[model samples]
Target: MTHIAVLGSTNMDLVAFVEKAPQRGETVTGREFRTIPGGKGANQAVAAARAGATVSMIGAVGNDSFGARLRSTLEHSGVETDHLRTTEGSSGTAHIVVDDHGGNAIVVIPGANGTVDHLVPGDEGLIATADALLLQLEIPLAAVLAGAQAARAHGVRTILTPAPAQPLLPELLAATDLLLPNEHEAAALTGRTDPRSAALALLERVPQVVVTLGAEGSLYATRDAEPVTVPAPRVTALDTTGAGDTFAGTLAVAITEGRPMPEALAWAAAAASLSVQRAGASESMPYRPEIEARYTS
Candidate 1:
């Protein structure tokens, strides 16, 4: 199995299902509410494990009930959590509102995640042993940069998801092997409204780029190769949360296993399609068998 290491945040997702999300300074009633385990790092870790990768998670959780649950959730999904530290505070949390249209709006409170600004003793060793290291912006930029540099030193491929979009440091991009961003994130990063143009702009810094287009599928670009676009399997979405993470994690596994770019993007799109048809974050990701079936269909 391809071994993947994830350096990111672990959050308890508090989700509210409603007909429509509340507007600024306006209150609205929700149909239902539930707490789910998530965070970009934890979601990718679960997605990779379910897709048959040997996954390890490196991050911190708080000394709270949510922290315990977050760790348990990752372990239950087959992710090794030896480097997940329990600190003395509240775990990170994402407050999400999902509408009937399957669209979502989220607010993330860093909480204990803010404490992971640097690597602990064993983090570098764990990253060095992996075929790929997954990163996201949910954690502090310091740790994200450190992890990327460590992966670069070990010659391990680094896949970064610039989610909850922010300005990226050139040094971090220099160390990243693949930049995975959604259409919105691509726009935020490159100031280009067009996905293709945004991706091309990113290539000036990173060697490769994959900008996911939700139901339309994903686009892949590399300096040495022609860009590839893969269409997603058509499906009615129930909740779109975690769909991008599903794509990133599955794509990382597919690439690490030597699948062609087109094939890998299609496979990852299939996983994302399956995820949107379900309800929660980590709970919505598909296993390897389900992804294979969807891909072949």
Candidate 2:
């Protein structure tokens, strides 16, 4: 089994589904309200586990009912939560609004996730044993940096998802083996809207970069070769919340299993395509067999 370590945030998602979002200072009703377990970190961990990786999650949650549900969700998805800590306050939460067309807007409350400013003693040991360490910006930057440094010290691959895009410090970039960002994030980071140009620019900071283009698939770039745009299977999307997470997690699993970059991107795309046809984050992710069937079909 492929061992993957994730050191990040865990949150309870409060979602509202509607035909269209309300304007500022205006009130509108939604079709339904639901709560789900998600946080970029938790979602990615669940994605990797569902893709057949033996995933160990290292993060913090609050001592609340939502936190309990979040923990149980990961455990149910086959993720090892031995290092998941529970703090004395509310768990992190994302106030999400999903439009009928599958687009979404979200507001994240840090809660316990903000408290994880740095790693505890056992965190490094957990990262050292993994094939790759999956990280996101939902948690504190200091903790993200510490996780990256530890992974570097242990010679473990570090895959950083620069989500909720923000300025990246130089030290963190040096420790990163792969940087994954969506097209908008790439443009925000590099000031380049064209995926190829943006990807090439990112390569100067990290050894490799993958820019996800939604239905257009993903662009892969490395210092050693020219960039390639892998195409995604065309499919109607119902919800795109977990699509990127599914892609990143499945890509990590594929790489660990020794698939070439091109083949791995294809597998990841297939997995993500399956996700968009469903609803909710984590719940939308496809399993290993499902991904294989989609890829082969």
Candidate 3:
């Protein structure tokens, strides 16, 4: 199996399902509510594991009930959590609202996630053993940069998801092997509303980029090759939460397994399609067999 390392955050997702999301300063009734285990890092870890990768998670959870559940959830999903630390105070949490259209809005509280500013003992070694390292912006930028740098030093491929987009440092870009961003995030990073334009612009900094277009699929670009566009499997979405992470994590597994870029992107898109058809984050990711079935259909 391809070994993947994840450096990111762990959060309990507090999700509210409603007919429509409330507007600013507005009160609206929700149909249902559920607390799900998530966080960009944890979601990716679970996605990759379910996709048949031997995944290890490196991050921190709080000394609260959510923290214990978070770690248990990862372990249950077959992710090794030897490097996942338990710190003081509350675990991270994402306050999420899902509308009937399958669209979502989220607010993240860093909590214990904010404390992971740097790698603790054994993090570098764990990263060094991986075929690929998955990263996201949910944790401290310092930790993200450090993880990327460590992966670079070990010649391990680093896949970064720049969600909740922010200005990135040159050093972090230099260390990243693949920069995966959704349409909105790509536009934010490159000032190009077009996904293709944004991906091309991103190639100037990172050698490779994948810009995800919801429903339409994903675009892959590299410094020295023609871009590839992979279409998503047509399906109705139930809750679009965690779809992007599903794509990123599954893509890493496909790539590490030596699938061609086009095939890899399509496989990842299949996983994302399955995720959106279900509710919650980590709970929604499909397993390897399900992904294969969807991709082949």
What candidate 2 gets wrong by more than 4 Å, as runs, is none
- List the candidates' TM-scores in order: 0.99, 0.99, 0.99
lDDT score, residue 153, model 1? 100
Model 3 agreement with the true structure over 1-297: per-residue lDDT tens digits: 999999999999999999999999999999999999999999999999999999999999999999999999999999999999999999999999999999999999999999999998899999999999999999989999999999999999999999779999999999999999999999999999999989999999999999999999999999999888889999999999999999999999999999999999999999999999999999999999999999998
Q: Rate residue 17 of model 3 by lDDT.
A: 100
Q: Between 1 and 2, whose lDDT is larger?
A: 1
Among residues 3 or more apart in sequence or in different chains, the pairs in candidate 1 whose N, CA or C atoms overlap within 3 Å are none
For model 3, give the RMSD to the true fold: 0.6
User: Which pairs clash in model 2?
Assistant: none
Q: For candidate 2, write residues 1-297 as lDDT tens digits.
A: 899999888888899999998889988889999898999999999999999999999999999999999999999999999899999999999999988999999999999999999989898998999999999999999999999999999999999999889999899999999999999999999999998999999998999999999999999999999999999999998888878988988899998989999999999999999999988898888899999999999
* lDDT of residue 13 for candidate 1: 99
Superior by TM-score: candidate 2 or candidate 3:
3
True-vs-predicted CA distance for residue 136, candidate 1, Å: 0.2
Q: How many clashes does each candidate structure show, in the order listed?
A: 0, 0, 0
RMSD of each: 0.6, 0.8, 0.6
